[model samples]
Target: MNNFVLLEYAAWGISALLGLWMLADLIYTDRTYSEEMLTSSQEGDIEDSLVIDPTQQGGQK
Candidate 1:
């Protein structure tokens, strides 16, 4: 019933909670998204769609 024993139990409880959360998240993601969709390369395509121009956005010249 010392402070160290209480701290150790708290640490174990946090660890168990984190592990269960990660497991649930993994299962949810696996069931919601396909492997190919998760692995698709859409970063560049999204970046190319943006118009980055301070002048056109009403900024000082």
Candidate 2:
């Protein structure tokens, strides 16, 4: 096989390994944690904390 063909195979092999790893990690984490905990996020809390009144940034009209 040519160098290019061999490199292509290597790239595909690496990609397959990475995909498998992610899948396995997902399964392991799901089995190890609760659904609510897995899906829980602080996005709302973060958004609420960023309140910026326009008056605070500049002189009021």
Candidate 3:
């Protein structure tokens, strides 16, 4: 009987640990994805700004 009780507690502890681990992984994944999206958008903005207008260099010769 005592062994059964110990086994039950062990199972509960393992279950709780697995749940926490999964939650942590989900949060981390979401944060990483968001950062990557922000970085990519910022890069696009930089590229657009770098575009040059040849006509703006004062009428062509």
Candidate 4:
């Protein structure tokens, strides 16, 4: 009976630890960028002409 109680306590401790680990992982997962940051990055790329086509530059085929 004492061994069974010890096993139960160990199982509960492991379960609680796993739940806490999962919660922490979810909470610290991604450092999401702001909308303003994304918009500014897109605008900077456009301003730099980073998406221009070489054929279009020569007035097409």
Query: lDDT (CA) for every model shown?
Result: 0.83, 0.83, 0.75, 0.72
Compose the digit string of candidate 2's lDDT tens values, residues 1-61: 9999999999999999999999999999999999998886555554463345557767477
TM-score of each: 0.63, 0.68, 0.53, 0.48
Regarding TM-score, does 3 or 4 come out ahead? 3
RMSD in angstroms, candidate 3?
A: 15.4
* Stretches of model 4 off by over 4 angstroms after superposition: 30-61
Q: Is candidate 1 or candidate 2 better by TM-score?
A: 2
The parts of candidate 1 lying over 4 Å away from their true place are: 42-61
How much is 10 displaced in model 4, in angstroms? 0.4
TM-score of 3: 0.53
lDDT of 3 by residue, 30-57 (tens): 8878766645533345446334454765
Residue range with the least summed lDDT across 10 consecutive positions in model 3:
41-50
- Residue 38 displacement in candidate 4 (angstroms): 14
Q: Give per-residue CA lDDT, model 1, range 1-61, as digits (tens).
A: 9999999999999999999999999999989999997886555554563444558677679
Cα RMSD of all models vs. native, in order, equals 8.3, 10.2, 15.4, 12.8
Ranking by TM-score: 2, 1, 3, 4
lDDT of 2 at 57: 62
Deviation from native of the Cα of residue 51 in model 1, angstroms: 14
